[model samples]
Target: MGVLSNLKPTESELEILQILWEKGDCTVRDVHEILGKNKDAGYTTTLKLMQIMHEKGLVTRDTSSKTHIYKALINQQKTEQQLVTKMIDNVFNGSAARLVMQALGNHTASKEEIDSIKKYLDELGNK
Candidate 1:
């Protein structure tokens, strides 16, 4: 757990973080454009959400130039782990096996993905 271990991003904030994590660093316009493709979002709403995220320590804004650049301060992997851990605890009664079983039962795992999962399980078994 790092500084952001306890910080849980809201759905809207997570959307912005996804853009930042994928694009590295971006201006509000950059994120807004990409977000516009998926949902009906207003520019000011995105800007305001990003500003709040900065205050929450989820992102950092550099105001050196005319347009401010924003970068994700939270680690993507850590955030995913945190969310998944919470899900396992709350939704699956702390049973990771149940979660995995439900996921595999409901969704299709590609052959490659199955192979990777098998490999990971093998590694875990070794440990």
Candidate 2:
């Protein structure tokens, strides 16, 4: 776990983190280019956000070379779990079942996804 394992990244910071998580270590320009595809984000803004993320211990910067490379320090699965747990507790009144039902109710699950859910439930029942 990272020092800031409990840290909840701001939406912009989360966007940068998603890039780092998917692409591994990246230069600020690399992230900025990808973000530009979705929104009008300046290069310096991405750099500043990445710098702030480094200060927050959410990512590490390798500065041995001229161009700095950044990588996510927090595990993606752990961060997802933390956020989901918080959402379940606060938004769903701590009811995982309600959360599941709400998600399934709103979103269309594919046959394969429904089969996977059933398999998971079967495994839980067996345990």
Candidate 3:
């Protein structure tokens, strides 16, 4: 709902952004190593994906040092909001109530989580 409302990075780019967000700034090697821990991506693949992300302005690189450090240019919350908005529009036919119903029905909600959601809804009503 903020800036970059139309920006939607690919799944791989999002994965890299997650790493950058968690690790702050990282080199290709650092990303590759972390990615390799879960999947079978080659170092070159990681490097090429990062290069594309940089070109797309999804990330920024500092080349002052020998190894370039890449950081996510987009904020995580903004990106998440953009993605969720798109999902609601496309998958729920712009029906937020339908989306919320499907989510709550499909997943098990703990009492604490349900209470939290109720509190948030109450706050929205106050607003």
Candidate 4:
């Protein structure tokens, strides 16, 4: 029971949301410019996608000014956690351990990262 239940942003929407999350409230042109630097995307395309996201409740905009500034309505951490949970359930048969093992095996963890994971696990065990 979280704010973002059943709300999955499409890959394109996620890209825009990521920009909003990182840059904070932004106009369509601001988003479009930043996104364009990465790949081939049109201003109208970014604008339409942002408008659709607003309709989906994924973002909110302040329209008092001529140039509207949009902000993500969903919490980034919660959304990411939900996505990972779904992936674990569907792709890993609900085995968190398998997911962790696979991630660790696939990506080499630095010493600091390993230590951080160990510390986090210890805290979880204590809880």
Whose TM-score is greatest here?
1
State the weakest 10-residue window (summed lDDT) of model 4: 1-10
Candidate numbers, best TM-score first, in rank order: 1, 2, 4, 3
Q: After superposition, how far is residue 15 of candidate 1 from its true place, in Å?
A: 1.3
- Leading candidate by lDDT: 1
Q: Model 1 shows how many backbone clashes?
A: 0
lDDT of 4 by residue, 63-110 (tens): 999999999999888888988998899999999999999999999999
Candidate 4 wrongly placed segments (more than 4 Å)? none
- Which tens-of-lDDT digit does each residue in 9-87 have in candidate 3? 8899999999999999999999999999999999999999999988989999999999999999999887887888899
lDDT of 1 by residue, 1-127 (tens): 5665567789999999999999899999999999999999999999999999999999999999999999999889988888898899999999999999999999999999999999999999999
lDDT of 1 at 91: 100
Q: How accurate is candidate 4 locally (lDDT)?
A: 0.91
Against the true structure, what is each candidate's TM-score?
0.93, 0.90, 0.86, 0.89
lDDT scores of the candidates, listed in order: 0.93, 0.90, 0.92, 0.91
Shift in Å, residue 59, candidate 1: 0.3
- Which is superior by TM-score, 1 or 4? 1
Worst 10 residues of 1 by lDDT: 1-10
Error in Å for residue 20 of model 1? 1.0
